[model samples]
Target: MTLIGRTHAREIETLSLDSADTRNALSAALVGELADALTDCAGDAGVRAVVLTHTGSTFCAGADLRDPPHPDALVGLLRQIVTLRKPVLARITGHVRAGGLGLLAACDLAVASTRSDFAFTEVRIGVAPAVISLTVLPRTDPRALARHYLTGARFDAAEAVRTGLLTAAGDDVDAVLEPILDGLRRSSPQGLAETKQLLTAKVLEAFDRDAADLTALSARLFSSPQAREGMTAFLERRDPSWAV
Candidate 1:
C-alpha cells in the first residue's frame, strides 16, 4: 500500500500524505516513499512545483513511535525538500505537530486553513525537536518559537504564519492556494529553480553545519529513560510522570 498519493494537474504535482490511520506519521516507510516521489518530481520537466498536503484531520502527528525513521533519515528528508530543484509548497487543513513542523518549514511556501493548529510536541515525549531544528530554526522567529518549543502548546494557523511556519491561512485552504498555484504555473521553470536556490541557501547552510549534531541529539534523547517513560505514558493515554 502506498503511503503517498500522487496527482498532477497543469504544471504542479500534489503529494498527499495518505496514512490517515497514523495521522500520516513519518514512519521509515513513509519517509522513503516521499523522498522517492520528490525525486521523481524533481526529474520530471512537466512538474514545475510540488504541493505537500495530507488527507485527514491531522496533517502529521510527528514520527511514528511504532516504526520511527532514523534521525539521519529524517534529516536527509528535510534537506531534500529544501534542496529540491522544483519549488515545494505545503497545503494544510488540519493539525501538525513535532516533526511535521520540520516538513512544513522545509517547503518554499506553506498555507493552511484557519482550522489548522500546530505544536512542537517532542518536549511532551521527553525528546527535543533536535534534528528538525535544522530546518525549523532557520525559518521561524526564535522568540516566538521558544515558548512553543518548551511547553508543547498548541497554536493556531495565524500564529504559525506569524512565526514563519506558514505563508498564509484562511477559512478555505484551496481558495488560499489557488492564486499561489497559478503564480507557480506561470513562472518559468529556470526562474523558479534559481529563485528557490537563493531562498534556501541559508537553510542549506544550517543543514550542513548542524544536522549531524542534531541527529545525534535526537537519537540519544529518544533512547533515554525519560523518553521511554514518556512514550509509555503517551501510548497508555495518560500524562507522563514528569508532567507535573
Candidate 2:
C-alpha cells in the first residue's frame, strides 16, 4: 500500500506514506490514497488532528517522473492539508526534496530531525516549482527562496526552521512534537477549526487564484525536451547535458 492510515488516542490520526521503494515518491496512486485518507479524517469529528509522515530514509523524493506526473493531484493534496479544519502536522524523519517541501509547507506545523535535509530541486530537472510555490512562497523567507529555488542546493533542518518550513528541528522529532500535540489536544475542536480558518484565509485565496495556472505550467515543463533529458539523466545517475 502506498499509504497507511490509523487513528490513535481517538483523536490523533496519522497518514503515513509507505512507498519506501520509491522513497515515498508522489506517484498518482500515493497521492490519491493520501487525498482519500485526509478527506476521511476531515469528515470525522473524532479526529482532532492529522499527522503526515513517512517510512524509510527519504521522506519523499518529489514526483515519480518515471510515471506520468500529476501536478494537479499534488496541488489538491496541499490545498486539502492547508484548508483542513483540524491541525495537520508533518513529522519528518528523513530527507525531503522538491514537491515534498511543498507538503512540509502545507502542514500547520512540522517537526523534523536535525539530520533531515531539504531542497527545492525542480529547477535542476528543468522544471520550476510552480504549484508548490503557492504554498511555499507564502511561508519561506524571500531571500532563501531566491537562492535555494534557483540553486537546488540541499539545506539543513535549522535553516528549514529559520525559513519557516518547520516549527522545530531536533535530534528527537517525537520529543519536539509531543508538546505541540499536547497543546493541540487542549483546544476545543470548534476553536481549532475557526482559528485555522483565520490563519489560512490568505493561503486559500492563493490556491483558488493560482493553482490552475501553476498546475498547467508544471505539466508543460515536465513534458518539455529539457525536462525529459534532465529526468532521464537523473534516473540514469548521470548529470544532465546542461550541468556545468
Candidate 3:
C-alpha cells in the first residue's frame, strides 16, 4: 500500500494497490489507505493531477468477497473520490471486472490498455452492482447499462470507451496514460478544481436523494425471493427470470 504525492511537472498522487495475489481488491485496509491518500492529495496545494494505477498485471479485481467491508466504510472511500477537488485518473493495464469496474468508474478519467477488459460480474454473484450504479450509470448509455446489467456481461476496451466510461483506450498502458497526464498538466489546476467541484455538486445533489432510494431498493432487492432464486440459478449454471 503506497500513496505517494509530489509536485514536479504537476501535483500528482498515486495509489499503489500492490496486492499482487489479490489483484488489488478493495479490502477495508486498502480503502482506509486510499481514503487517507486521497485526502492528502486533495489537501496539498501543489498537487494538480492524480494517477491511480496499480501494481502487477491487473489493475483491480474490485473487493474480495471473503470480507466485504461495512457499507459505510466502502461508501466513505468512494465519497472522497467523488468529492475530490483535483482531477483523478484511472490507469488500467490488465483485467478489470466486477467491483474493479466500480472503482474505475469512480475516476473522472479512465485510460485503459487495448488488451484490458471491463466486466460487471455482480449479477452472476447474486447481487447487483448497486454501489457502482452511481458512478457508472451516469456515464454509460441507458441501452448499454440495460444490456450489461441484465447479463453481467464482459466487454473490452473499445466498448468501454463507446459506452463513455473510458476517455481513451489505447493499444497499451503507457500510450493510454501519457496523453491523459499531459492533458491534465495543460489545464489550469484551479479550473480543474472548479470543474470537479461543479461535477461533484451536481452528483452530490442527486446523490443525497438517490442514496435513500438505493438503500430502499437494495434492502428490498436482497430480502426478496427473487435475489435468492437468482443466486441459486447463477450457481446452478442457469438463467434467472427476475421478472417472473
Candidate 4:
C-alpha cells in the first residue's frame, strides 16, 4: 500500500508509511507520497500538529537500499520535515534503525514504547549517516551519538529518551498519543506555525541554509570506501570493522 495521509477534525494530521509488508521501506513512490502529504499538511490551515508514524512492527528500516529511490529523495524529505510549519511528533514502536533514526530525530517530540529500539546504523551499512546525522546530532547525546553511528547499537526506548532522541517512553502507546494530540490541540495554530519556523531556524540556519552543501557531504560519504565496506558487512550479516 502507498503511504497514507490522514487529517482529523481535531487538527491532528498523520502521515503513515503504509507499506507494512516491506517493513515500510522508504521507496521512491512512498517518499513522493510522503512529500506530497507533508506539503498538504503544511498548507492546511486546520492542521495544528502532525504525527509521523508507520503501520507495523518496524517503524522504518530506512531507505530501500535495493533499487532504492534516488539518494536525493531522502535528503529532500528530511529538508521538508525540518522546514514544515507545525509541531511534529514521532510515535515509535519497534526496531527502528538507520535512517529511521533520522525520522525520529526529525520531529519536535518523539514518544516511544518501552520495548522500542533505536539505532543509527548507516555506518554499519557502509554509508555515513550524513543525511540524518546533521539534525540528529543536536537532539542526541554526543556520547550516544558516538556509539550509535559508529557501532550501530540498538538501545531501548528508555535509553532513547535519556539520549534525547525521545521525550518519554510510554506504557501504552495509544494512550500516550492521545494526550500528546490533546496537548498540541491546545496550542494556537498560529503559534504552532511560528514556533515551528523558529525551531527550524535555530537548528538548520547555521549550516543547511540552502541544503547545497548537503549534496557534497552526502556524495563524499556515500561513495567512500567505508560506506562500501559497511554496507557489504551488513548484507553479509557480519559486524563492520568500522566498530573496530
What's the lDDT for all of these models? 0.94, 0.89, 0.74, 0.77
Candidate scoring better on lDDT of 1 and 4: 1
- Encode model 1's per-residue lDDT on 1-244: one tens digit a residue: 9999999999899999999999999999999999999999989999999999999899899999999999888988998999999999999999999999999999999999999999999999899999889989999999999999999999999999999999999999999999999998889999999999999999999988988889889889999999999999999999999877
- Order of candidates by TM-score, top first? 1, 2, 4, 3
lDDT of 3 by residue, 123-142 (tens): 76567777667677777778
Candidate 2: tens digits of C-alpha lDDT, residues 18-72? 9898998888888888898988998998898999888899888988887644887
State the weakest 10-residue window (summed lDDT) of model 3: 1-10
TM-score for predicted model 3 compared with the true structure? 0.84
lDDT per residue for candidate 4 within 1-244, as digits (tens), equals: 5467465667888777787877887778887888899899889888888898877898988877664656578777877788788888888777788777877888888887888887776756666676676578767889877987787777788888888889888888878788878877888877877887877775576336635566577678766888777767766888778665
By TM-score, is 1 or 4 better? 1
Better of 2 and 3 by lDDT: 2
> How many residue pairs in model 3 have overlapping backbones?
3
Q: Could you tally the backbone clashes for each prediction? A: 0, 0, 3, 5
Model 2 off-target regions past 4 Å? 5-7
Best by lDDT: 1
**What is the alpha-carbon lDDT for the whole of candidate 3?**
0.74
State in Å the error of residue 48, model 4. 1.6
